[model samples]
Target: MSLLNEDATIPFISRYRKEITGNLDEVQIGEIVKFKELFEALEKRKISILKTLEEQNVLTTELSQKIHNSQDFISLEDLYLPFKKKRKTKAETARLQGLEPLAKMIMSQNVNNLEQTASKYTSKEVATIDDAMEGARFIIAEWINERTDIRNNIRRELERFATISSKIIKSKIDEEKAQKFKDYFDWNEALKNIPSHRLLAILRAENEGFIRVKIEIDSERILQRIENRIIKSQNNCSAQIEFAIQDAYKRLLFPSLSNEALSIAKEKADEDAINVFTKNLKQLLLGSPLGEKRVLAIDPGFKSGCKLVCLNEQGDLLHNENIYPHQPQNQTNEAIKKIGSLVDAYKIDAIAIGNGTASRETEELVKKIFFKDKVDVFVVSEAGASIYSASKIARDEFPNYDVTVRGSVSIGRRLQDPLAELVKIDAKSIGVGQYQHDVDQTKLKKSLDTTVESCVNTVGVNINTASESLLSYVSGIGPKLAENIVNYRNEKGSFTSRKEIKKVPRLGGKAFEQAAGFLRIKNGKNPLDNSAVHPESYVLVDKIAKDLKINIADLIGNKDILQKINLQHYVSETIGLPTLQDIVKELEKPGLDPREKAKVFSFDANIKTIADLKTGQLLPGIVNNITNFGCFVDIGIKESGLIHISNLSDTFVKDVNAIVNLQQQIIVKVLEVDVVRKRIQLALVK
Candidate 1:
């Protein structure tokens, strides 16, 4: 908490301050940060409520004490419900007629001859005994609604017994767009037992005007429960109080508590959806990288031709053109000759083809050609490549190029380093989420941003070669500081050491302390600059080297020597064995990427389209998108197949992630295929 209060980032605190944090991981620290902010917001709301109560002259000693002791928002709001300002209401109108005394008489159950007592309160507003009685009942109903115990009781009942039901709107039932939600047209389920995906689907149907959703419970039972608590005796006054209780239950309590219950359910659903998205996004961002390979990338198309770009080892665009290797232009010979010449001319290391229109055909063409040197062929997912191409970052990076050329460059770079190129595009646009648009956008963005930051910081960045977009995700450096770092590098040349990061504008001591370990400077003056070791511990490293009779360069990557050093000997009050152990691990392989090397995967050659697929046939596929229900796999065709949770294993499956991950290669047996609808069902084959 203290570290977070000092503006320290979660990655920095969890990684560098292990002694202070007792070795808490990033997820635990993030939970602490979330609750800390929530606590502060609750405190702020309490202050606002107190000031409002004081201004209204309703801050009694007991009420003030209750407000101060309230632990949750629902309880605090219940305490303030009676005093909350309101527009014209039935109770207010009855109060204007001076009927409060009669209402209190009925509530106490002490009134005899209630008709005569009601008649005594009659006036122009209440012209008869019946009118007065009705007005008094309205005031009594409002009082019942405001009671904390009554409202809480209703909430408890709703939580335990509520059922959610949806029905199609008769007028819109035949509409073409409404057919997609027909499954939910007449659905009923226990609210607590409904899955998040199903609930979200029903809510979406309601939002789209195709269905009317309702939350319901046993109203008669609830009414009896309320009457049991409120009625003291059977009399005329009890009958009048009973009328008020029914009015309150129908008009005020049920509606409020039902909506609150639905809101809580929706919030839980959103959290579930966002967690799945967060995990997929993290996996996609941390996907294996080909590691700075010189590449020739192609964005395949049929009529418009395949857009081709050659990127150097640094991913700088050296050349771009067009190749038509598909139908409508029988220029396969020309395309083949052009590709061969370019590969030889640039000494290409790999060929990355975007897995989009005419991808399989282009891969076959490229595979048939004879090149001078060995080159691996990769089909990269172009999920957000078009989005990134049209973005301002792409425009800034390649101002003179068109969207097609820029997209081809993005595909190639994604093959080389997915994290660096992906951070430049929006996480939502990458297409890993389920119902992303329906979830809370603000929370989704925050979670995705945090996942990107954690992945980037975990892998560590090369300060000299990293773009501003990638640099922005480094622990403490945001967009402005990242821009400043880039501008400083452009003006002064590549950074020679990690210490030079401090010279960038607006980068203070704290920022440097948090960011330095995650930003590597390769071949720097000090060997530790390229590792995950902070500069504050440089003196300690120097001392260790002096004791070993070796230089810093000799000590680094010397596993035999590093293992012999007693980490306990270096532990101090501020630094413990955890920190020392991490240092030794980093020393084993300084500046090593934690991600594995990207491998070339090939889909079955016989499968080209949905028409080619046969039931019970096994084929290779990649898991593309995941939801709470199942995962979608791209099986070398336009329609990705669904591997439902049940089909994922013969045993009971609890989590989809436990079965497969994003971009994971697996063999799946075809269970069913609907060519007209382009839906394919697959089962994971062990």
Candidate 2:
């Protein structure tokens, strides 16, 4: 591949640089790239090995083939290991002790009786039968160990049928820190079916040293089969050597083969689990929008009075009230007046009720009030609301209001800007993502942070409503300066223009350049704030509009003139042809929310649990999760239904994810519903 083209996008290469990737799809091309890198590295390694072997006069054609055919890094290294210089061992010593002829004679099985075979080698060096037997056993062990074919066959067979075994040692022998491994002791399970979570659990346990574990494939049948194959003809005289060879295969070969089997199994598990997590993350970041809602927010409570905050169409909180809706029976009159006035005064469009303790009761009250008024309302998921409420961002924004009022604000803001509000809280606290804690924390944090960044950048921020927490998530800024910007704004009053952001502490030209376009300021000095076109691109926009001889207002959404512009003319090396083309397309449809369809899905009102489902009953559901086992659809939040791997197919389905995806809208028929455990099994209806 050309180095220049290598750095380009897969989409670009697949469409334009066909010669480099051979007209392959994105996935196939990615695999080819990875394989090519690995092959090149392998070739370099082979050259070094060949040079050394040639110097030693040990390089042979057969040996070269074996080395080249090694499938992985481990197997390649293993192939080179025997020829590697090492310390003296029992087998090496046996050869030096003049017992080679006797060992080879017994391996060929040229004698009948054990004692007779032993006696035939009765020289001074192999003086006794015991000494002769010892040398013979060591050679046989080495023979079995070196047979790569036997090793590969046994490893494959073991993986098909082996059980992993472990035993916990006594407490006194192991430290207190090692006690966690005790549970894994004496455990036995098939390697193929074990999950990644469980595999890692066992690995952690093994690291603690309270357990001795082995992957034990019942190789009795295989050992007997090998004996029959290798021994060829059986004789009473050769029986002793046969027994010794079988013992060597069992003691020396089985464990090593089992280790290889486990490695392969773990690799497969990691691939599957990684794919599952990545899909889940992508789906979560793609949750539907409620758009810009004019919300009447209710922070549900009982003892502590419920805080009511009303926001405008742009999500700026316009009114705040504290009501004892669920408690303080005497305060009922005051509560009614405050709530009624706010709803009527601002023409509060929707009641964004928090799903908290008094949420259902509050919903009931809103339903009664809005029923006559023709208002819409939705019970929003209030996950991590408390975290947001107590946060510094919340306090900074709504200093006059208490935590309850801040919570109410968050609920309203979340409805208006899910991506913006969600970024403020930790993703783990949001209850999405994976076994986040168990995985490499730094890696997980990096990935999750990227997901949030991508989502935020895709849906540009409203600079006026954005808090420091929200602004930090914008392309260039971070938490510290985001806070500084908010502080500066608080002191300086509402930012009238995007250009004024440079006045904030440490907000230099570079930061402003990266962040300017994404931080939209509606009704700001520049009309481009309402769109995605940056201030740096303001000249470009004016130039285009000038050439077209139309006003900037008329220039937008007019596809005919926009398409005629040569993007290559404006493109610099820093901004390539690809980037210029994308910018032009984006400018055509500025401030577009790059998300999946913003469709609201409501489950059956009566069906709160899986027990309410019936087999063959078709239900319109949202795909919550997709795994190798099957797709899981959420009829309601209480539980999701599983469509097994078998049911994921009208034809053969190798990967269930290929058939369906996370957060996708699909209809599924309930196949089995278990009420007690709250498991719902569903199959795609179509």
Per-prediction TM-score, please? 0.98, 0.65
Clashes of 2: 3
Residue 235 error for model 2, in Å?
A: 9.7
In the predicted model 1, the residue pairs found to clash are none
Candidate 1 structure, TM-score to reference: 0.98
> What is the Cα root-mean-square deviation between model 1 and the actual structure?
1.2
Best lDDT among the predictions, by candidate number? 1
Question: What C-alpha RMSD separates each model from the true structure?
Answer: 1.2, 7.9
Q: What are the runs in model 2 whose C-alpha is more than 4 Å off? A: 1-71, 77-150, 158-252, 299-338, 345-347, 355-361, 371-374, 383-410, 425-429, 432-450, 461-547, 550-554, 565-580, 596-626, 630-673, 680-686
In candidate 1, what are the lDDT values of residues 364-418, reduced to their tens digit? Answer: 8999999877899999999999999999999999999999999999999999999
Every candidate's lDDT? 0.93, 0.69
